[model samples]
Target: MSESAQAADPVAYIQHHLTNWSTSQPKSIADFNVLHLDVIIFSALLGGLLIFIAKKIGENLSLDNPSKLQSVAEMVVEFVNDQIKNVFPHPDKLIGPLALTVFVWVLAMNAMDLLPVDLLPSLWTGILGLFGADPSHVYLKVVPTTNLDTTLGLALCVFVLILAYNFKSKGPMGYLKMFLFHPFGKFFIPVNIVMTTIEELAKPLSLGLRLFGNLFAGELVFLLIALLTLGAGFSFGLFIWFPMQVLLDLAWLLFHLLVITLQAFIFMVLTIVYLGMADATADDH
Candidate 1:
């Protein structure tokens, strides 16, 4: 859109930015009517990028005069291994790599927020227009972590690992005993069942919602900051908003760098903790 068009109705522009590139319109809150193409595309691209970088670093490793990329890669691997050893006492062969993947993938996804909000969308819209699609309808959201489905999907994958470890460490009967007897003993088996169910369910719910809520709020704030720069038309007074906008934008962006990294670390740490908890045998439970 032209500057005049955007300035004419900033609300519409904000709404357009918020919209997703989906397969179709959703009919209801529970409907799975449309797939978020933007999220899928960005996520796949990031995942592929991670794989490519890892492969390149692995193939180029040198003990003598290591490259910066190799050094960073080793550092990341060592950090994740230490974290896993600390939390997951009997760390499985898969745990270190899984934790590393979660940390890097999430950090990459969250890093998308650092890009100018309108950059990808405007570029995508222009490309779509050239292909005979309506530029106005080419909504694109580059941040996959900000999408609930993506976050929840990650949580669910962790949940499955929790279940697997639970079974592996405890066996079926012991697992049943975990839910049937516990904090209240055999007399309170009914309460034990209900409480245990809720506790288990809360893990994934909290995991997904925490990441989604934070990123979604950050994305909205960026949009609002962007909106502050707009006006119906040019005026001498408009210059006054620019400095405030610049200061706020820089401050928030700096703070958000910590937020993105912290969130990714938190998610990785919690996944290790949850899996460790699941690894508890009947005796420990």
Candidate 2:
């Protein structure tokens, strides 16, 4: 943590921060990704917290002058409800709640960026080391959106929901019939199948990659700011260094909160929209 200590092991320190706490190495080069334990635990915990808040909001509904919590809840609920109404018709039964929960949970997960970048991961690694593992080998990335595993896991969840809606809205035969017949007609079943497969693959891949790309960029920016702060006085002749670092970090942190919320909202809404498309009775025919 000291300047000399950091200088002595620059690459090692940076590499340690970059590594993930994973179960094991994946099978191949294509499967090289390992899980980030911090992302998984915190994201799930935030999701549960979101659900708890939603439940509490439902319990303490007041029709008069809305309290601060109620107002916030109303705004989010109304936003999701409006989107559901506009995009997915007859969606009162399920899409409303689904959209609401997805938005809240995704936002909560993204909000993990509000924590100082290395704090959680450092603490986590230390705790893991106490159980006899090597501290250097204990790697964890706290930013869920920065990790492909985190985004892909969420995208996979959306995939499952889309599949469920497909089956629910249309029987197995109806669902198959859409790809097998509707789009390109009977003569081009092969082509239609390929197109459909691409469409399906694109959903999760795009969804995950979109979130991953944005968050990863934001994280890189933060890291760059950190490096600047570290190299400030030594490189820049000890000029109003700490204050400048604080200001820069503050500005970026403020901007990143907006980025985090927007990215989460977009991911959730896109997820709902995609699933709604699958539930489209018109599209199936």
Q: Write the per-residue lDDT of candidate 2 for residues 117-194, one digit (tens) a residue.
A: 668866876787789876656677777777788788789988988888888878798789878876789999999988
RMSD of 2: 3.4
Name the runs in model 1 displaced over 4 angstroms.
1-6, 281-285
lDDT of 1 by residue, 130-206 (tens): 88886666789999998888999999999999999889988899889989996699999999999999999999989
TM-scores, each model vs. reference = 0.94, 0.83
Q: By how many angstroms RMSD does model 1 differ from the true structure? A: 2.0
Per-residue lDDT value at 239 in model 1? 84
* Residue 127 displacement in candidate 2 (angstroms): 5.8
**Judged by lDDT, which candidate is best?**
1
Point out the worst 10-residue segment of candidate 2 by lDDT.
Answer: 228-237
lDDT for model 1: 0.88
RMSD values, in order shown: 2.0, 3.4
